[model samples]
Target: MAVPHLVQAVAETRGLGTDAARYWLELLALTAPDDRLIRELNGWTGKDIDAAATELQQRGLVIEARRRGATRTRFLPGGWMEVSGPDRPMDVWKAPHHLLWEDDRVHGMIPGCPQVVPPAELYLDVWERIRGGDEPGYTELRTTPHRRKRR
Candidate 1:
């Protein structure tokens, strides 16, 4: 399984549970460059911040990159894509809401918040960008050679 920076942080810091940590990761990924800064800015103390940063580094999500004689930690990307539903990729329209209504219910927030739902046209626009047209198709090739069975 791919390790997101915040998932490792959550596991190490012990501040937020998995779900809350995932949510915070998504939110922080939009703005923060690294998990350590995000945790620190969110009020995590010395040991917790250090542990979370160490966890992120250990998980391979955070990496030290050097440029112009300066080293910095940055998320490596890819793992940040948190798909809304099943493990397999699905059409955006077909997938469940990014967060379920039950999440709001448990957290004591308003249920079925329409403001979070983007219009159908937005989904179609994104799909068009991905599919390149209305035609339903995808490329496939068998990479492995067919092995002969031993008698």
Candidate 2:
């Protein structure tokens, strides 16, 4: 899937790469119509805040409002950002080769293949699944039925 135009536009405007833009967009979406106080935040000067607010307005992602003599910024209607990407393999983090168990059960075995496939990739997938807390295998194993079966 091709990356969405909104993602690219935001990335370009914010000077953040596509990946960081994706994260920031998703986070902004959660804020809805709430006004962002850019200047009052720590580590941000008024000039930086004004520049960011101007950029956001120019991009039509946000609108500037004046309330109680203070300028505020909020997302425009239907300005929610979305990101997409082509289906491609991504590198997965894995433990070193030496850390993996030597047992045959830990390695994936293919029928009619004498070689033992290293489980680093598989371990990465399982680790990601567990970290996400929604993997089917992990869920099943967590359920009482699976525990009973194992017992």
Candidate 3:
């Protein structure tokens, strides 16, 4: 299944949530780092944050926002920052592996995937339907009602 619009975009930043998606886009579009303080987006991290950042920088979707610590300066992909500030958004798309890294589930299963596959060996889907809080009636995929008992 196709990844949801937000999910695909979120993978550009961090997790598969709208906030995560917007964070990276905001950082890319922001002229100054201070702009992020309001939402406290300046301080955020996760196990995958570094990996995501590295991938984005390599793809040119992001640049070093700073020069200290893990923060370096970011610039458009393939553009020499020494000569010009940055390149247009279009240029980054031409770079190698320009697209964001999407997990197989997102690329293969559902958009903005939540990784709820559990164990593939067991009947996980059946359990999901039973646990989704929706009362499961004795019915088939069409959800046909069970036979009624005579009064």
Candidate 4:
């Protein structure tokens, strides 16, 4: 079955809304290279994206990676900082939410990051862009390729 159909089927079997299931699938897609369908599905405003990301965070499925220059900080649920400090100048809480996932790793809160590209593909895009003397800055791509706990 196609991805959408498969997701819908499994969701129905589990008594879950297909839309929610599809949305999470779309979120997972955001971590890899982009496709036309993924782009169309992700056309929501930043606010909508943030709301969905918040939902994922609440589910404990992903964590946020806040970056500034050469420094990066990861935040877990409940606004807990991976590194402790009251004087950390970055107001990550107020930043826009974006997620990047590749393989088993999920990264969140990358500002200005676009939706989905596989880590290897994204790295290649970045490399090619740099080779052409262009800043990669989340260049879009096409075609490609999550966690949880039991109850």
Candidate 5:
């Protein structure tokens, strides 16, 4: 279970329900994979930020890395992924369009958002990348253990 920075933050600062926190974690992972997660820090005050982050690490929802004089961290979603649908690595579906539709699952606000990774690509891409997040986004894996495309 990897701990995304935002998930760790919400859990610590807002006491975000685990389910909601998980939802948002997946959301951000797909929507803003490269974006730094300090928004979680910004949403807090005083030492609550550090407190929440520490608790998140304790819960195994996040991990921290230290190098030189700098430190970094992020979230992990394997627990949720293991129990999710289709019994495979699922991709993040992005749709920032009121034209698309929103629910507990997928939605978005970026129309003609070709600038985005084409959310449709995530689910198609995840099965390969989920095992080892060694690549940039979830779609860069070409050596999937279960190499079967959906029909």
Candidate 6:
């Protein structure tokens, strides 16, 4: 099957309900981030959060966001920051990965980790940590040995 068709098939098999799909699509269209999106996905699908994220990554739909300037790597997704535009003064938390369906496929390697969670989930987790007065850091991408060998 073609890439597009394969993506669609995977989406269908995963069955992101109308509501969840709408929410995800809206966020992607707006280029905005929502803390509740991943939580809602978990509730809707009853799949482990990490598992859902892994599935998405395996499909080449999303990539882990790299932090701008951090020495030590941490797995906090909320720490991933991007400047929206030159005019924007404050950094906004955005989804780490772009919507792959729009571009057909992602270029370059997709980062993998032992405990991968969707950006929204990671963002929320980091947010909570910060609220609790914890420092947010970078997360090192650890690809499997086979993947590393491919590089």
Runs off by more than 4 Å, candidate 4: 9-20, 30-40, 67-151
The C-alpha lDDT values of all candidates are 0.36, 0.34, 0.34, 0.37, 0.37, 0.34
Better of 4 and 5 by TM-score: 4
Q: Top TM-score: which candidate number?
A: 4
TM-score of each candidate structure, all chains considered together: 0.28, 0.27, 0.27, 0.31, 0.28, 0.28
- lDDT by residue for model 3 (25-119), tens: 43333222232231354345443345545665564455544332212344333332111112112222112222223321113122221233332
Between candidates 1 and 5, which one is better according to TM-score? Answer: 1
- Residue-pair clashes per candidate: 0, 1, 6, 7, 13, 3
Model 1: per-residue lDDT, tens digit, 25-123? 432222222345445445555455456545555654334443221122443322222222322221222223333334212121233222234433333
| Model 6 regions more than 4 Å off | 1-10, 13-27, 34-37, 40-47, 68-81, 84-151
- Any runs in candidate 5 off by more than 4 Å, and if so which? 1-42, 67-71, 74-151
Cα lDDT of model 2 by residue, 1-151, tens digit: 1125655765775575554443334323221212242223223465644555565556554455432222234333222112112211111111112222333222213221221224333333333433465212111235454344564
Candidate 4 structure quality by residue, lDDT tens digits, 77-112: 222212122222222221122242221222343533
Candidate that beats the other on TM-score, 4 or 6, i.e. the better one: 4
Q: Model 1: number of clashes? A: 0
CA lDDT, candidate 2, residue 44 = 49
Query: How well does model 5 score by local distance difference test?
Result: 0.37
Give the Å error, residue 14, model 5.
14
